[model samples]
Target: MKIVEQSGKETGQGRGRALWAAVAVIAIAAAGVVGGKIALKSKVNELVAERGGKAGAVEVDFLGRIHLRDVTLPLGGRSNARIAAIDGRPKILFLNGTLEMTGLDIELPTARILVPHASVEDANLDPATLTELISRKSAAPLAKRIDRFAAKRVSATEVAITQAIAGSEQKTVYRQVNLTDIANGSVARYSADGASFEFAMAIPDGAGGSKQEVMTGSIGQMTGQDFDAAYMARLYTEKAGPDDKEPRPLYGPLSAKAIAFSNGQARFAYDEMRSSGFSMRMPAEPLLETLEKLTSVTNPEELEPEERRAFFGRLLSLADIIGKGDMEMLGLKIDAPAKAGEAEGEKVKLAVDRMALQLDGRRLDAALHGVSMGEGGDYVKFSEASMTGFSWDSTLEALKKMAGLDEQQLETFPFTTLLPEFGTFRVAGIDVNLPNPDTGADSTGTEGYADETGETDALAAEGLMPDAEQEAGADQQTNQPVTSMEKPAAAVPERIRFTLKNYELALTKPFNGIPTDIRFSYEDLSVPVPAKAQDETSVQLRKLGFDELVVSSNIQAAWDEPSQNLAIKDISVSGKDVGSFSVSGLMGGFTKDFFSGDPAMAQVALLGLTAREMKLEIEDKGGMAKGIKFYADQNGMTEDQARGMLTMMAAAVLQQLAADQPKLQGPVDALSRFIAKPGTFTLTVRSKAETGIGAFDLIAASENPMLLLDKVDLEATAQ
Candidate 1:
C-alpha cells in the first residue's frame, strides 16, 4: 500500500496537499493495525516451534492501555466455553491506543481447554511506546485453566509438573498433559532446564500430602502409554484418533521407552534396559518400620522372650541385600571398640569387595578390591563377595525390613543374639584325668579313661566293682578336709564325677548359614562322660543343663544344591557345649510382640534329629575252627550273599540286649554287653543318616573282633 507523507506545517488546502495529508494519516493507522496482528502471531508460533510442541489456531485480541479482550488457545472445550480476559499492560511510554473486541466466545479445543482471562497492564502501539513483555506473551492463564479441567475428567490422569520451581513466589509450573481426544497434549511450562521435556520417569517415593517425587527421565521424549516422539509426531500432525481430533488407541500404550535425562546421564535407547536398579538410603526410621511388619517385634521389653530369634536371621539375610558386595559402597565399616588394656594392632585390611551389574547392554562394575571374571554371556553374574567388618548391627536393622518386620519390632531385636545361637563355648581346653589303660607311655591314650568296655567281661555287666565304688567314693570326699565318710547322700553318691581333662575347641564361621565345609577343631579337646553314678558331678548333666549337647559320631546327611544330591557326610563329636541355635535375632521378635500381640510362632521350628537314630554296619568274614566246623553245621552261605545280608538294624541288637537283661530296659542306658558283640563284619555303605538332632554314631565293635573301638579317630580326610 503506497502512502504519501506531509507535515502539518507546510499545509495548503490545494487538492494535492489535501490528498497527501489524508494518505499519510490513513497509512499510519493501517500500519498500526497490521503490525499488531503480525507481531502477536509471530511470537506464538515461535514459542511452539522452539519447544518442539504442537498447538491449534490461536487468536489474541486487545483493548484499553494494557488489557487483552480475547485470547483463544486451542484447549479441548468442556462443552464449549470462551476466551475470558487478558489484562497485563506493556509499560508503554507516550501513545494511547486500544483495540477492543465487543464479543468473544470459543474455548480452546485442542492442546488444552483454556478459557483465557488475561490483562496486560498498559498496552500501546505507538512506535515510541513499547511495553515490557513480562511473559513474552501470557499463556499461564490458558495452561492453568486447562490443568484444572483435566483433573476433573480423570482421577488418575492429570497435568503433572514435569519440572517446577517450587517454594518461591514466582514459581514456574511445568506440566505434561495427554489429550487423547485432541490427538495431542503439550509439554508445557517455562522450564528453562528442559525438564518438562522428559518423556519417561521414575518417582522414588510418594506419600499423601506434599509428596516429594523426583521425575527421572530425559528430554525430547513423550512419556506415558509407551508413546514417543516418532509416534506422537505422526499422531498429532495427522490428527489421527477415534474422531479426527483424538489420538487413536493405536498410538497409545505410550511409554517413554528408555528416555534420557541430565544431558547425557540418561538417553532413550529403545527400551532395552529390563531393569536399572538403583539403591536409595532412606531415613532409618522408615527402614525400621519395614522390618517390624515382617516379624513380631515392637519394643525393647519384648525382645528377649519372643523376638530374639528371627531378628538375627533376617538381619543376616538383609546384609546380603546390597547384593553381597556393597558394604563399602554403603559406607559401612567395622570398627572394633578399643579394649581397656590392649593396643590396636596393624589395621585390618579389606581383601575383596566387588559388585557387578548388567541390564540390557549397560554394565556397572564397582569394587574396592581387585577381581576377575568371565564376561556375562546371557545373564550377569557376580562372584567373590566379601565385606569385611561390616556393621553387623546396621545389617540386622536392614534385615528387619527385608524380613518384613515393622520398625518397632527391629528396635527390640538387636544383632547380638546371633552370637549365642552359634553355640561357641567360652572355655576351650581341658584334660581327662583318668588312669591309663596301657602301662607304657599310654601312646594311644586309652589313659584318657576306661576308654571302652570289652564285651567279654561278664562281671562288668553286673555293674558291681570295688574299684568303681572306690573311684566314686574318692571323688566325693573333700580333698581339703581329709575326712573319712561312712556314708554319703544316696543322690549325691549316685552322680558320677569325672575330672575335666583339658579339651579345646575354637570355631571360625559365620552364624546361621555357617559354611558347610567349616570345621571347629582343637588340639587338646577332651570331655569326660558320666564317670561314676554321681549325676551332679557328671559332665553330661552339666552339658544338658546348658547347651544340651550330646556326645557321639554325628552321621550327617544334607543336600548340596550344586551337586543336586542328598550328600552323605559324618562328624564325630562329643562335647559339653550346650546352647540354643535359634533362627531369631534377639531384636527381631520384640517389635511384633507389643503391637500385634505374639509372634513367637515363627521360632527356630523343631530341633532336627541327632545322630543317635543313626546306625552303622560292619561286615567281616571269619572261618570257624576247622575241626569244630567239620563236625557242626552253622548256616552255610557264600561270602558275597553273607556279606550283603549281614546288614542288620543296630536298634534290633540294642532291643535284644534289653530283652535279655531285664535291668537294661528303659532307653537302653548306653550299649550293654549282652547283645551279640559284632564278630568280624566289614561294613560297606554309601550313606550314614541320623533320625533326629542331638543323636549321632558310636562304634561299639571293631572289624578284627568284637573288641571295643577306642581312639577311633580312625580319621577320614578329603580325597
Candidate 2:
C-alpha cells in the first residue's frame, strides 16, 4: 500500500511539470511570432525606403505570411509603381518569398501599364537587384544577379499598356500570360493568349509630304520556349563598344498563330509564324533612339542633308550587325478591295503557302513556296523559289562608308564595292494567265488566235499584216496636228500567257564584284507570239512558222584566277520544233583588273585578252527547212530555186573572203554546201600561235577581216 501511494505522488508531480513545460513553449512561440512581425515590417520599410517608396500597413501571420497595403515605389528612371495589396509567404526570413500582387499599376517614362493580378510561385528574389533592374540601372550587374534568381512560375491576367507618342496614343493588351520554370535569368516556357495592339506612325507620301498611317493588329496565341531573359535585358540595356566582343544573345524558339494586321485599305494575315535560333549583337537602345528621332519628324524633307546621311549610316550599321536567325510563315495572305468601276468581287488576292528566311553570320537565305496572286482564270503562280548564300557583309560596309561621303565624294566612289556575293537562285514551275486585251478573256494559248496545229486563217492572225482601214486611220492621225489640250489613249499592255518549268542561276568566286564562276539555265520557257509584230526581226521570226517561242537554254562558264583562264564549258539554246545551237570555248589573259570598275583599267585589260580555241555546232530540227520555205514564199519562187539562190549568195560572200585569205577556202565551201542543204553544221577555230591570238591583234584586224585568218586555224563541216 505504501509503495503504490509513493508512485501516485511521483506521477502527479510529473504531470504538473509537463504542463509548465507546455506553457513555456507557448510563451516562446508567441514571442517569436511578435519578433518576426517586427523584423519583417522593419525589413520591408527599409527596402521601401531604399527604393524611395512609401510603405503602408504591414501585417505578418503565424505562418510567416506577410501582407502589405497601399504601397508606392519608384521603379527607376522616371517610372513609378503602385500596388493596392501584396501577399506573400517568405521562404527564408524576409529576403525572398512567393508573392501575389493585386491591382498593380506602373507609370513609365513614356508608357503606363496596368495589371489586375499577378503571382510568382517559389520565387527567390534579391530586392536590390530587382530595384536596380526596375530603375534601369546598369544591366551587366543585373544580368549577373539573374544567375541567383529562382522562380518556378509567374502568371498575370488582363495586362494592358498605353503610351502617348507624338500626339498619338497607342494601346496594347494581353488577355492572359504565363511564364513557367523561370530560373537562372531564363524562362523555360512563355505563353500569351489574345494579344492585340494599335500602332500609328508617319510615312512619306512620295510628294514631299507625310501622312499618318494607323495599323491595328492581333495575335491569337504567342509562345516561346527556352527564352533567355537576362541576355535580352543585357543586350537592350548595354551599348556595344568597339572592343566589346560579347557574342550575340540567343532567344530560343518562338511561335505565333492567327496573326493579322489591317489598315484601312488592305489586310494581311498569316495562319502561323515561327522563329528559331534568333540572336542579335546590335544594341537596341541606339537603334531605338535613332528610330524615335526619325519618327518624331513630321516632315522628313525638312531634315538637313547631313542628318539624312547620318540616318542612312545608322541603317547600314544596323544591317551589318544583324546576327543569325531564321523565321518561317505559313498561309500568308493579303487582300484589298477593288476600286470603283471594277467588276463585282474583283478584289486583289494574294497567298503563299510558306515563306522562310534564314541568316547565318554574313550569309542570308530565303525561300517561297506555293505562291499565287489574283483569282479565277487571271492568276500568277509559282511552285517554289529559293535564294541561298547571299552574303552582304562587304556590301553593307561599302554602303556605310559611302553614307558619310558628300555628293562629290560619292561621284568618284568605286560602286563595285557595293556588289554582294550571291550563290544559287532558283524558281520552278511558274505559270501565268491573264486577260487578253484583244479577246477580252483569259488566254491560255500561247499562239494568239492560232489553233493547236499552228495554222492561222487570216493574215492578220499571223501578226504579219495589219487591217488596211486601221493602217489608213493611223497614217491620218500621224499626219494630223494636235489642236487641243488632250492626250491620246494609252496603249493597252499586251496580255501574255507564260509558263516556265525551271530557271536557275548559280554564281561563285567573285572578283571585284564580278562572278568568276557562273551557271545559268532555264527549261521549257513558253511565251505567246505577239498579236502584231513590232520589228522586222520579229516579223521574219513569225514568218518562219513560229506561232509561239518555246525555248530552253543553258550556260556554264568558269574562270581560273591563278591561271587567268576563262572557260566556257557550254552555251546551248534550243527551241521546240526548231533547232539547237551550242558553243564551247577557252580564253586566257583575263586579269582581275578587267573587273576593277575603272574604265581605263578595263580597257587595258581587254587589250591583253587572248582566244585559245572555240567550237560552234548547229543541229537543225526542221527549222532550216521551214526557213527555206519561208524564203521561197517571200520571193514568190519554188523551194529549190530559193535554196539555189541563197547558196549562191552565201558562196559569193565567202568566195570574196577566200580570195582575200586562201586559208578560209575550206570553211567557205563547207558553209555554202550547208546553206544549200539544210543540215547540221560545225565550225571550229584554234589559235595557230603557241600562246593564242591576242585581243589587241584581233582588234587591229577588224578593219581588214581577212587578216584574222592568218592568226587562227579554222575548220568547218556540213552534215
Candidate 3:
C-alpha cells in the first residue's frame, strides 16, 4: 500500500514520498514556520487519506492544535504504533514539543505494549543530534554522542506493560515516571502505588499445574543518575577476554526508598528506610583518592608495576567505609509439599513473622521474631532470635594498617592479626526450643532410627562388645588388675550455652596505641538434657540444667616497646561451677625490631618468644582428683590401681617441670600435696627466676625430664 504525498507542487503517490513529505513538513515547522500550522495539518490529513484508513484520521482544531485519532505510524515494514488519540501543541521554533495521548499501543512480531495515558512536555531536543546518536551502531559511540544532547522535564503517567512468552503473558505497571535534565548528567525517578504483578510459574504441584503468583508492593520512589557515556560504561559494563573492550562509565548513583515487593509466600521491603530515616555514605574515599592520583598520569597503564599494585591496594581500602542503615521484612515463608515418592510429614515449611537489620556507625544488629517451622514435625522454633552490638571499626582499621604495603608484603602479612581486634561482638538474647524426634515406625526401619538398610543397634552392639576373655587379656597385658567394670561417666552437657541469654567478646585498643585488654563473658547460660526413650534414635528433652553457668575472662597484655617485650598484667578464666584460674607473665625479647625489614620475616620472628615470672593459680574443689580416677577406671583398673597410676603420672609431670628449672620443685611439692587431698585445694606455681619456664615445656610436656629438689619453691594447701 502506497501513501500519496501532498505539497505546494503535486507529488507522486508512494510510501517514501509520503513519509518524506510528512517529515519535511514537521522539519519546516521546526525550522520556523515554512508552512503554517494549517498547511501542516492538511498535509498530515492528506497522508492519512492516502493510506486508505491504514493510517487513522488527522484534524486541525481552530486553536491550531493537532488532533490524532486511531493513527497508525509505520516504522518501516517491521513494526507500527497505533495512537487512539493525541492532543498537544508542537513548538517548532524552540525545537520543543508537548504531547498528550490516550490508549497508545505498540505492536511487534513477538510483543505488544499498551499505555493508557502518557504526557510528555518541555522536551527540547535537537533533531540532528538525535539522528546522529541513533545512527551509531556501538554503545560506546552512542554514549559519547548522548553526552552532547540534553532533554528535560519529561514525565509519563500510568504505564501498562505485557510480555508474552511460550503462550503466557507477564504483566507489569508503573504509576508515574519522570526524566529530569538528561544530558551530561541527568536524574530519572519512578514510582508505583502498590503495583500488582501476576504471572503463572511452573512448579512441582501434585497435578502438574502452574502456580499463580501475585506480587504486590508500593515502590515509593527510585532515582538514578546518568553521567557521561565513558563513566557509565566503566561503572556498569563488563567485557570478556580477548574479544572484550574497555567501556566508558554512564550512570552515577542510584537509590531506592520505601521499596517493597512480594509474592504471596515471600515478602521483601525496606519500610524502615523511610520511617527510620535511614541514610548511608558508601565507603569510596580510598577509591576516590587512588583515582585522583591517577589523574596526573595520562594513562594509568603507563605507570610502573609497583605503582599499579599500590593503586589497586588503595582501592580495596574503600570497602571499609562502614555504611549505616536499617532494613526490614514481613511474612517471609517457603513451603514445599511432600512429593509422590516421599513419606508423609515430609513436607517442609519455614516461616518468619518479621526480620530486621540495623547498622549505626560501626555496629550492626539484626532481629528475628515468630520464627517457626511449617513442616517436618516442627522440631525447632524460637519466638525471638536477636543479635545486637557488634562493631567492625577496629577490625577494619587493623586491616587498613597493612594497606600501604606492596603486593608481596601484603601477601606475607598476617591477616589474623586483625581477628582479635574486632572491637566487640555481643548477642544479648537467643532462646531456642527443639522437640523430640518422630517415633512412629515406618516400613523403612525402626521408629525414629529410620535405617534404610535394615541395620539394627543389636548388630552394632555385637561389634562393640568383645568376648570376656579378650577383655581380661587386654587388662593383663598392661599388668593392670580390674576388680570390677567401671561405669562410664555421664556425657557432659554441651558447653555451647544454646539457651544463652547473653554473650560478649572484646579486644580493646588501649590508650597506649597497642592491642591490649581481651574480655569474654557468658551469662544466664544453660543446656538441655534429654531423657532416654523407647526408640534409641529419639530422646525427649526431660530437663534443662547447668543453669546460671556464668563464665568470664578478662586478660590484659601490653607491649613494652623499649624492651621489646609483651607484659601480661593479668589473665584469668573463671566460672561458677569450675574453679578459678589465673596466669601472669612477662614474654621478654619479642624481637619486633629485628623483623622490621620484611613483613614475612616479621611473622617468623614473632616465634622467638621468651617469658619470665610466669605464674599460675588454681582453686579446685577436689574435682581434679575425682576426674583423674574416673579416667583411669575407664581404662579397666581398680580404684586403688587408678590412684597409684595417677601418682606416678604426677611425679612424671613434675620431673619435666624440674628439668626446665630445678627451682620448680617448690611448685611440684605443692601440686603433690593438693593431689593427696580429697577436699578443696589451692595450688600456686611461680617461676623462681626471670626465666620461669620454657614455652615448649608449658605447651607440650617434656620427655626424659631431669628433677632436682634443692631449688624448689612451690606451695599447696587443702581445706
For lDDT, the strongest prediction is: 2
TM-score of 1: 0.20
Q: Say which prediction, candidate 1 or candidate 3, comes out ahead on lDDT.
A: 3
Note the Cα lDDT for every prediction shown: 0.31, 0.79, 0.54
Candidate 2 Cα lDDT to native: 0.79
lDDT of 2 by residue, 482-578 (tens): 3222222223323557899999999877776777899999998997666565545556778887767889999999998888888999999998888
Q: Rank the candidates by lDDT, best first.
A: 2, 3, 1
lDDT score at residue 241, model 3, on the 0-100 scale: 36
* TM-scores of all predicted structures: 0.20, 0.79, 0.47
TM-score of 3: 0.47
Kindly list the per-residue Cα lDDT of model 3 for residues 1-719, writing each as its tens digit: 13332452354346678999999987875655434556767655655544443546676654446788888766434567788998865545655756688888887765677878877666543334434443333344433564655555556676666777667776766666666665563344333343444555554445766555545555555555543433333222322234223222223444445556645445455532322334333323333345556555666455576676555555544443334556566665555444632434466666677777876666777777776663343334556666655555555665556645666887766564544324555655555433223322322311122222223333346786445687678788988775333222222221111455566666555321224545666655554333322222222212112323345565666666667677787687765545567777677666554324455765666556654555666666434554655566567787677777787888788778767776666656666766665444454444555544545554443443333222224555545
Best by TM-score: 2
Q: Model 1 residue 581 lDDT?
A: 14
Candidate 3 achieves a global lDDT of 0.54
After best superposition, candidate 2 residue 299: deviation in angstroms?
Answer: 15
Tens-digit lDDT string for candidate 1 (579-622) = 11111000111111121222353132112212222223322122
**Which of 1 and 3 is the better model by TM-score?**
3
Q: Report the error of model 2 at residue 289, Å.
A: 11
